[model samples]
Target: MRVLKQVLAVAAAGLVGSRAVAAVQDDPWLTLLLGTATAVAALLAYQWVVRRTERRDVTELARAGAGTRIVRGTLVGFAMFAAVIVTIALLGGYHVHGLGSVTGVVGLFGFMAAAAVTEELLFRGLLFRLVEERLGTWLSLLVTGVLFGLIHLANPDASVWGATAITIEAGFMLAACYAATRTLWVPIGLHFGWNFAAGGIFSVVVSGNGESKGLLDATMSGPTLLSGGDFGPEASLYTVLAGLALTVVFLGLAHRRGRIVPRRRPVDAPAADVTVS
Candidate 1:
């Protein structure tokens, strides 16, 4: 019931935010700013709802309630995506060109900021966390991750392989990020970094959402598997491998930290010992 309430809160916040962004579409800056404000507001509402319904600490809903760790996770996400784009450029699969408009960059940042926060809250904060309690870590990861990627099918120029790649790569990788730290901040940061880099920095087609100008104009070429074809670099084989590598790293860290949620067994809970008064 708590989970359900949280989901409703997130949805309501998102709906209001989307409408607000739409109203300000004429002004990119305002739109981005509004989007961000609404996203944060939504998350706060989600936390409030969870606390009210479940009487849970709610700090975990806010990423372990640690500002430092939240910042660290965000930076790590940016770095991970940066690594992928950098590797692609080094391989000659991506060629960078002239600088883009400052407005474009800022707008992308705003849009990405909103997206990263809201999506992470919905998928990782709500879905994965609740699901994990019932289904265990690995299965919840699979379910939520696939749902994450599958949802992207709505993006323009999306393809089967692209969706599949997202499922295997981003879906698992982002979930793993949460599992590692038992928080959503890192995954949100990672999501923002990946999207911003794809659409705003490298000037690639982001999940086939058409080309949005970034800091640079990049001409992407090479095989469909390597270049990700019409869908963009995210659909590339390299992207999947990179995501897989991170998933492995984060999962290992989580396991070592004793944070990985184990599968529930059919056996009943052991009875508490009763002592004579």
Candidate 2:
């Protein structure tokens, strides 16, 4: 029933999105912004309500150090951006230029911010943790990883191999990040960095659609394995490998501390009662 509710909610959101897109066909930017905002807001609102009902303070979500977490997250995200720029420059001779370039940067940031909060909330906060409550951390990580990759099937440039690779690689990596750190912030930064660097800097389709402005109008001069063909960097072998390596490193370091109450717990019990039980 919980799974059913989640599926229905996603489907409803998709339906609303299609309608919104059709209604705002004349203004692409406005449409994208508004639709994205609406979806994000709705998701946040729903989650907020759930947290409230559970008597869980939403602010007490992540166990990662707040000030340090933000700094580290932002740094990791910026590093990802730098890595992409370096990759593009090495492969396709990309470069940043002009005040005009800032527009693309800002737009990319907007998209990243949206993606960070929404995707983290969906995957880490709800899905991953839900599975964790039932299956334990390792199994939940695997499930969330596959689920994350599967969710991208509707993307314009998504391909079978790419999607499969993402499921096995990026999905697992992200789940591992969340599980290890017990914080959504790190994964959110990584996600934002990966997308922005790949699309906003390299002038490639992030998942499928081309970015507003990027360093180079790259023509993938190599095979699909080298250039990710249609599914973009998220599906690229390099990204998969990189994400996997990072996940390992993060897992090694994370203390695995957080407030994830297990399923079938006595909700009404006091702290002392909980310990006694």
Candidate 3:
């Protein structure tokens, strides 16, 4: 019941916020305003629901050092995507034409911000955290990661391979990020940075959402494996490799920090007797 309540509350805010942004997408100012509001509302919803349902504080979203964590995650995310784009460029798959709209970039920042926060809250903050209590870290990661990929299948240019790529690249990697830090801020920042770089900076189709008028007039060509074709660079082999590398690194950190929760065994024992890791 606790998990269900939290999920529904956060999901409701995310859905309503996304629809509002889409409805005002044509107007950059409105998009930015509503997107920011939506992001805030999502956070509030998560905090409210957690307190109401579980009667516990949301320490995962504590404000202490949030700015630093988010900034660091954003920088890492941008650098990772930039590296992938550079690799594609070297392979003759990517090219930049000229500068694009500043307004478009502003709108994309807001849009991506809302998406990142809400998604991290729903997926990692609630689903993975709650499930991990029962299934352990690895099993929860697998379940939530697959669900994340499956949801993206609703995108316009989605495919089996594309969904699979997202499962590995974003779903698993982002969850691992949360596992390592034990906070939603890092994953949220990473998610925003990656999507913004893809759509706002590179002017590429983001996760098959469609053409984005961003800061650069960019074009992609070459094999789908290298270029990611219509589904965007997120589906590129380089993205998967990069995501896998991060996942390994974060999981290693998690293991070292004793953050890896083990599967709960059926026994007649006190809850306090069970040790994590």
Candidate 4:
């Protein structure tokens, strides 16, 4: 029953967000506000359902709040993506063109911020956490990660390889962040920062979804394997490698902290109450 609620909650969130975004596609700022609003509403719904159905305290999760962990996580995400950009630059795959406009900057930032929060709330806070309760850690991670990647196929220039890249890089790493910090805020921050830096700051294509411009006016050139083609630098092998490295670090930290959920075995029912009927 709890599992059913979780599924319903996630589906409801997707509907709310998709519909809201569609309604305000013309105004980037509106899209941003509505996007965030949708995420918050979805979160409340999730907590309400979980608390009512499972009888668990939702206080701790809320009390965790968006604090220093969020800041640090955002910075870490930026740094990792920076490393990818730098690698591509060194390889002569990227070039600086000029500066971007104010409107462009804010648009991308708001869009990405909304996207980050929405995705983290749905994927980590709901799906991964709920699934872990039954499927355990590794299996939950794999399932959520694949779904995350598959969903990205809806992006503008998405491809099989791009989806695969997103699955392995983002899906697992973000889940690991939740495991390590035991909160959704960190992963939300991480997602926001990565997207903002890539799309808003660096003026690059993000996840093949679309492009955004900011301070740096740059363009990607060279092989798709390195440049990530139309799917953007996110498809670059560098991103995959960096994401995997982060996943290892976060997962190791979570394991050391004893946060990884162990697989549970089913207990046999009292051998069917034995014979005398």
For model 1, the run of ten residues with the poorest summed lDDT: 59-68
Top TM-score model: 3
Model 4, 18-86: lDDT tens per residue? 687767766767766776676667667767877888788864256455677778879999999999999
Q: How does model 2 fare in lDDT? A: 0.61
Which residue pairs in candidate 1 have backbone atoms (N, alpha carbon, C) closer than 3 angstroms, thus clashing?
200-214
75-165 in candidate 1: lDDT tens per residue? 7766766787788778888887888656777777777777777888888889998899888999999999999889989887989899999
Q: Please write out the lDDT profile of model 2 over residues 91-208, one tens digit for every residue.
A: 7534444323444554555555555556666677678877888777667777888887777787777777777777766687777777666766667666766666665656666766
Query: How close to the true structure is residue 256 of candidate 2, measured as C-alpha lDDT?
Result: 45
lDDT of 2 at 275: 57
Better of 1 and 4 by TM-score: 1
List the candidate 4 regions with Cα displacement exceeding 4 Å: 22-26, 269-277
Who is ahead in lDDT, 1 or 4?
Answer: 4
lDDT against the true structure, per candidate, is 0.81, 0.61, 0.92, 0.83
Off by over 4 Å in 3: 268-277
Runs with alpha carbons beyond 4 Å of true place in candidate 2 = 2-43, 59-68, 84-101, 215-219, 255-277
Better of 2 and 3 by TM-score: 3
lDDT of 1: 0.81
| TM-score of candidate 4 to 2 decimals | 0.88
